[model samples]
Target: MMKNNVSAFVKAVSLAVCAALILSASAVFRAQAEKTLDQMQSELDSINAALSQKQDDYDSLNAQIGEQKSRLGALNSQISNMDAQLDSLNAKIRILNGQLLELNKQIEKLESEINVLNDRIQQALDQIAEKERQIEATKQLLLERLRATYIAGNSTELEVLLSSNDLSSFLTRSELLQRVAENDDRLIRQLEKEQKELSELTRALAADKAELVAKKEKVEQERTSVIVKQSELQTSADAVHKKQNEIEAKRNEVNKILATLDTNSEEYRRQIAFYESQREKADSAIEAYIRAHATTTVPSTNEDGGTAPQTGDGMAWPVPYNNCYISSYFGYRDLYNTGNYRLHKGIDICVSGGSNGKKIVAADGGTVMIAGYHSSYGNYVTIDHGNGLVTLYAHASVLTVSAGDHVEKGQKIAEIGSTGDSTGPHLHFGVYDNASGQFVNPLNYVSMP
Candidate 1:
């Protein structure tokens, strides 16, 4: 009997030692898991920050593009105005060209008139010279006759008769002397009149030539002015065209820059997708680790040292409110009425009176693995029941528990409220099977209250 007792005592010590080793190892594993979770959370936060920065850059690029487009619009408007101005300038050029052509014609006509006047003046001068020669000859003849008369010294018809050989001879001499004097006098007067008329004609022709020359000079001056104006207009038009080309080149450059920005934006989107995928992977890892090492010691007794109430499958309903109904069911559905389908992953519960401020309890006795705010789940609590079973109560307004807190089944852990991705006040109750590594229907474990 003494040997048997000693054997039993030795066995008890061995069992106790084994348990202590197991608990120590578990504690070590738990510490490692927490460190890993921290690292993963840090990585996720870094990814999120990077995503936010990329989004800001994308927005800035878009704004720049918008500003560039606005500038392009202004440029186009300026181009349009320039085109209209060019058209007007060209029209003026056409009109000026026509006027120049007409002026050239007038100048040609005036030059021709001046040439004709010059020819007339030359002819008049020739006529005047011929008349002068005739006048000189006649004057010489008259002077000689006058000298003969003077030599005769007061001779009359009686003297002429006295000098004649006979009466008939005397009469003939008298008639010839009279005719000579009259012919000489008439020729001198005719020559003098012809010279005077030629002189007048030459002077008139010269005046006409001067007038034509002045008209031609005026026409030339007008043509020069028109040419200068046309040249200036052409220069202005050329400048406008140059500006248009420059603006077009700038526009092309901007378009190329926009294309590059688009490409960069696409690359940013790809990076965001990769990071989001990494975040999902990290979330899976966190869920796995939490499930694996969530509970070390599960107390058999409740806080009051009494047995907790449980349903048929070892889980109690999370909501104790009467007349509560399932607003949404688990599985795939078009929750947003969009064509895309998404997994519900949980059941949403609401009471008849109102689900606001409703109490949310733990489904079973376990340790709280997570009790905090989530972007999608709001104020939520995750409980780890032993044997790889876990429950999540999400979209709560108030949290009554914290992480690592031991909770009993039917113990209030949170209050129902419309937080996060919710349409109204309700409790999103989800059940995860860590053994299967997937979420299961909560209805499979807990019955409706």
Candidate 2:
């Protein structure tokens, strides 16, 4: 019996030593995991920052494009207005040309009239000269006849008295001679007056001709001005067209940049996908470890000796198997605080003895709120279980539920992954109180599988 007791004691001591070594190894692994998680979180933060900066750049470029487009539109409108003005100017030019042509025709007609008037004036002057010459010749002839009769002394008085047959008859003959001379003088004066009137008419016609020439010159100048204005309008139109083309080119450049950004965003999404797969595997391993090692009796305090609250609504085990281990724990942990600005709000679990791609079941029935990539959570899902309760699963390689979908307790919602701020395959599980809008330790609600 003593030898049996000794063997039992040896066996017990060996077991204790083995347990201590395992715990020490686990601590070392935990430390390594924490370090890895920190690195992942740092990279994730950088990616997020880059994404934000890219988005800002895109928005700024878009705004610039929009402004350019608006200016282009305004320019187009101005071009349209210019076109209308050009049309109006063209019409005015046409009307001016028509007026000029009419004025030219009128001037030509007036010039022709002036030429006829000049000829008439010259003819009138010639007639006046001929009349003056005839009058002078007649006066000379009369003078010679009178002088010869007087010099010859043809006994005019006695003859004249005998011819008259009385003194009174002789006196009547003398008076008639005087009246005939006066009538001849009056006829010459009338001819001189008619010549003067013809001279005045010629001078008036010349003045009218000069005025018409000046008006014609003015019309020509107006037509030249119209032509210059048309050229200016054309130049303005060309400038507007060039400006519009430049704006369009700028818009195309912005669009090209945005396209490139979209490609980068897609690449980031792919990286998130790959990491999620690894995280899921790690989570499954932890789950398996916890299932094998954890006792059935619920501990009053968690491993950290913190009493987590227990809410009755949908509180249950997440998995059916035993031997699962928590690879990470929740709340203000630095490992997942890559931004160096936020706390880690979830716990990581790995089924230490399970195969990869193991199913990660939902803790309770709920409606899926998210089932896709969250920049920080990676491939993740959130479920609103109603009544102020929400459950979150992160680093999932595959999700079986989507937003707005119903799920029952123990439903397989996703597979484990190492996505997002994770270094290895694991599950990041969280419980949120809808009332408080705060994260609560999920360890309070779910037991080790």
Candidate 3:
């Protein structure tokens, strides 16, 4: 009987030892899980910080773009003003050219008038010379007559007639003497009158020619001044044109800068979004891990109850309906019409009727790797199929799985809804090739029902 009692005591001690080991293992597992969660949380915090910094950078870039745009606007306005000034200068130049033309015409007319006056003066000079010659001739004739009278000793016409050889000679001599006296008087008077008239005409012509020459000089001066003014205006216009070209070139450079800035800002925004998504995924993963490990046995069924349709290849469509439309395809997408493209890492699914509250199913049987909320993905789930293939379902109203939970194909894992960064109720489904370390086209693995 003592042996039996000892054996029972031994068995009891062994039982106690086994129970202690089991409890210790459980405690160790819980501690390890907690430590992992802490590490993940730390990582999430780091990601959050990075996301914030990126967002700040994006904001700064946008501010810079705004400033550049303002500068561009000012430059454009300046260019407009410059253009107006150029136009005014051109108009002035044209008017000056017209004025110059008129001045040239006036100069030409004055030159013609001066030429005419010169001809008149020359004619007057010739006439005066001829009158002087006639006056000299008349004076010579008068001298000769005086000398003849002195030689005759003041003899009368009868004495002159007695000197004749006969009566006829005497009569002829008398008549000749009378005619010479009359001719001398008339010739002398005419010569004086002609000399006076010629002098007057010469004076008039000289005066008129001098006046015309002065007028011509004045017109020429005005023409020279107009030409100089036109040249100055042309110089100003040329300077303005050069300045405009320079400004236009500068504006073009600014435009290029703005384009580059816009591109950088967009890239930064995308990076921030990616970081946010990662952080949220990590957060949800931590929560799911905690929830899943809370119990001794992990639940195999959907945690958030729902029904889903199973349709497609080994990887099935994530949406409840097979007829769901693909709102966006996986690849580069132009979401903002900025002439810039962003990578769409997943396909967006929209169900018939209202997509909100529609069930989301796993594409294949796999272990849940992550189940959490994200700023970009909203409520999301990531399932790890055997091998390097993984599937993701995002933008859900509700998540029905936790990390570490086993999910079967077509199992309801979430409900579709508009969540963070979503435009409407839809499912963002993605396939990731772990081996390649890149998200792939989900359509390559799954087919439309």
Candidate 4:
């Protein structure tokens, strides 16, 4: 009887010892889980801080772009004004040129008329000299006639008649002498009148010539002034043209900077989204693991009530339709239209033709860790396979799965849509390993056509 009692006591002690061990292990697991949750929170805080800094940087760049645009606009307006001024200057120069040409024509006409007047003056001068010579000859002939008459007779005609041989001869000689004196006076008076007319004409022509010369001098001075003004305007126009070119070059540079800023802002937003989704998935995963391991045995079925994938590794194409092509590759990429580089963390698969609301399947059997929007991802979904592998499907129109819902490989989990920063209707598929805390290329795991 005593031996049977000792056996029962031994059994009770063994049972107590087993119960204590189970309790100790459970406490240790729970503590580790709590610590893991704390670490996740810390990581999320860090990511949030980084995201905030990125947002600030993005905002600052936008502000700078705005200022640059304003400056560019002002520069353009100034250049336009300068162009107008230059055009005005050019117009004035053309008018000045026309005026100068007319002035030159006037000067030439004046010079020609002055030359004609000079010729007229010379002809008048020559005629005046001839008239003077004729007057002197006529005067000399009259003087000689007077001397001959005096020498012929010292007394009057009566005395001369007394000395004459006959009355008839004396009468004839006296009549001849009177006629010669009358003819001499007439010729001398005519020569003096002709000489006076020629001298007056010469004076008139000389006055005209002097007036024309003075007018030509005035015109020449005006032309000189106009030329100087044109030169000044031309200098101003050239300076304005040079300034406009410089402003245009600066504007081009600013335009490029604005383009780059836009691209960088977009990239920062994408990175923030990626980090948010990661944090969300981590939270869900920690919760799920705690719940699963809390029990003695792991669940046989998936959280979505589906069997494990037949392909044990759970590697498969995310989309069931084979009519798609890889739109973007994973790595540092040259983004379209931006001419800038970006580190793309996922592969974008798109349909050949145009379509919307297409099915997006799970890449592998896993629990749906997250199904919500996180900025640029827009209606994002994260799936956690049991082996620390996670798949992300972004830009979904609709989510068919919820958190903790298990999915099989190739099962529909979401619908593709142009949400967030998607340029078109496509799915951004990504894979991450929690152990490494980094994304891996999906091609390394899944084979897609």
Candidate 5:
């Protein structure tokens, strides 16, 4: 009996020691789990903060875009007004040109008339000179004849009457002499009248010529004034045309700016879609992991005899669909056959053979952290799954979630696609530890689909 009691006591001691060890392990595991939960909560808070900041940035960008659009609209209105003003100015210039042309024609006609009048005046002067010369010659011939008659003893009218041959003959001779004297006086009066008329005509013609010259000069002066005015108007018109061209150039610049803004807006929308899809996929994965690893109660205590909490502790599949296969695994390697080395931070899955609109599910429950495109990832999405863990989905066809939105596990977030630097239809999945701010292998936390 003593031997049996001793043996039983030894067995009891061993059982106690084993129980103690188990309790100790249980305590350690509980502590670790608590630590993990705290870390997860903290990460969730950080994700919320980041999402808020991103939302603010997005709002500010949207407001700026609106303001820019308004400015562009105003510029368009100004351009329209400028166009109308330019058209009016152009019409005025055309009318001015027509008037100038007509004025030139009138001036030409006036000049032609002035030249004709000058020729007529010159001809009149030549005729008057010829008449004066003929009159002078006739007067000289008459004077010579009168002198010869006086020297040859030809008496005056009374002397001729006294020298008559007889009473009857002398009376007849006296009558003849009286008749000749009367004819001479009449000839002298006629020559004097002709000379006076010729002189008056010459003076009239000279006055007419002077008047015509003055008129021509006046018309020429008017033409010069018109030409100067037209030139001034032409200069003003040219200035207006230049201003119109400047306005047109400004309008074109405005149009280009607007086009750039439009392109940026489109890119932003695409980025938003990509992020939404990623968030959805991450939520779905987390739900799947939770359902698969669910427990009825906390597990037994460890070596320390402490209880452990029930929790999900399994890898998650990034995508909901099972039709795809991984083409590349995450690791450090050279890409594109380039000498430069880089880390392959994500797994590339080929989904080309999958059904159309195959869903991409989330890897965990968390808030959407990033819902846009990165330069390298293209159409990408990022979700913070808490505990410093963030899952990324890239190259999605469509996204259904948004930044800052709370997502549950196993939610459908996107459709698989080949967007942005993808060789084929596939999902590039990655996980990043927020605490380390470095990429980790997605395979460590997510099951392959």
Candidate 6:
């Protein structure tokens, strides 16, 4: 009996020792997992920071573009005003030209009239010269008549009368002398009046010609001014047009910059995709290692594990929040549709606007087959319920269990997050037949409510 007791004590001690060793190993394993999680978190932070910076840059570019567009608008308005001014100037030029044309015709007419006036003045001057000569001749003739009368004297008149030897002959001689004197006086008066009238006409003609010439000079000066003003307006219009071209060129430059930014954005997306691809490979290796070693502690126990589950066709919703909507559906989708006809095998559910901090629960009671990070399904958890049932919950921010841990239906497993290759906070729930190791539609096994 004592030996039996001793043996039993020894067996208990051995079991305790084994338990202690397993606990120590589990602690070390957990510490390694925590280290890995920390590394992933640091990388995630860096990636997030880069994405944020990129977004800020894009926004700044958009703002700059907006400002440039506003400047363009102002420039366009200025250009429109300039165009209107140019049109107005052109109209003014046309009107001025027309006025100038009429002025030129008027000036030509004035010049013609001045030429006729000049000819009239020349004719008047010749008439004045002839009249002056006639006046001088008549004056000389009058002077000679007067002198001859004086020379004959009063006694000569009486002697001539006596010499006539008859009263009738004397009377005829006197009448002839009086008639000659009257003719000379009338000729002298006519020459003096003609000379004065001709002189007046010549003076008037010169004055009229001077006035016309002055008018022509004024018209020519006005035309010169108009030409200069037209040239100035044309130069102004040209400057405005040139400025508009410059603005357009600047707009093109801004557009080019925007295009380059677009290319840079695409590059950032590609870089993220490349890193995710590398992470996916690493995650697969880690999951494989976990699965190979963990299977001993956690059994895949259904004798008919090869068969597909029919009872758990409709299970509980994985997200424990109200107002949640399905972001994506499964079955032959573009999600993960890499060349090999990969259809979406999961359903993504999220709340409107956001789903962060929401709890993720299991659909049914099961042993946690895997609980760790995947590159595509970050901070994920998988459960193996009996009878060939397995469910995966992906894209979690916080994990609450580890491999080989038992969980219950509707129990919280993680927090919804925007991890892995996700655009926002959401849950990706999937189901599979462990027997066939094939994916199944999550919607078929999960009730929406």
Q: Highest lDDT among the candidates is held by which one?
A: 1
- Show how many residue pairs clash in every candidate, following the order shown: 0, 43, 1, 1, 30, 1
Q: Lowest summed lDDT over 10 consecutive residues: which window, candidate 2?
A: 334-343
Query: Candidate 2: TM-score?
Result: 0.43
**Candidate 3 per-residue C-alpha lDDT over 1-449 given as tens digits, one digit per residue, 9 for 90 to 100:** 99999999999999999999999999999789767866876777678668767867877888899999998998999899999999999999999999999989998998898888788878878887888888888888789879987996898767876788999988888888789889888988887898888788888878888888898899899989999999999999999899999999989999999999988988986786687568657755754553443322211222332111122335676775766889899998655333346578889999877899999998888788778776567788888775456678888999989988999999999999898667899999987655444566777777777
- What tens-digit string does per-residue lDDT give for candidate 1 at 299-381? 24336432332334478889997699999999887543323355787899998988899889998888898887654566888
After TM-score superposition, what is the CA distance of residue 90 in candidate 5 from its true location, in Å? 3.6
lDDT of 4 by residue, 92-194 (tens): 9889889889988998898899889988998999899888888888888778877886898676888869867898888887787678777788878888888
Q: Give per-residue CA lDDT, model 2, range 104-195, as digits (tens).
A: 66656766766776677677667767767766766776677678778977746567778896788898886676666676667656655665
Candidate 4, lDDT over the whole model? 0.75
- Highest TM-score scorer: 3
lDDT of 6 at 197: 83
Give Cα-based local distance difference scores for all models. 0.80, 0.63, 0.79, 0.75, 0.63, 0.72
For candidate 2, what's the RMSD?
A: 15.2
Ranking by lDDT: 1, 3, 4, 6, 2, 5
Question: In angstroms, how far off is 83's CA in candidate 6?
Answer: 7.3
Q: Is candidate 1 or candidate 6 better by TM-score?
A: 6
Better of 1 and 5 by lDDT: 1
Against the correct fold, how does model 6 do in TM-score?
0.56
**What would the per-residue lDDT of candidate 5 be over residues 161-239, giving only the tens digit for each residue?**
5776667777788787677767666666766677677667657756765776676577667667766766776676677
Query: TM-scores of the models, in the given order?
Result: 0.54, 0.43, 0.61, 0.56, 0.45, 0.56
Name every residue pair that clashes in candidate 4: 304-406
The residue-level lDDT of candidate 1 at 41 comes to 62
Instruction: RMSD for all candidates, in order, please.
Output: 11.0, 15.2, 8.1, 8.9, 14.2, 8.2
> Which regions of candidate 3 fall more than 4 Å away from where they truly are?
1-20, 73-77, 80-159, 163-165, 168-172, 178-313, 321-345, 348-359, 364-369, 374-377, 384-389, 400-412, 415-426, 432-440
Ten residues in sequence with the least summed lDDT for candidate 4: 290-299
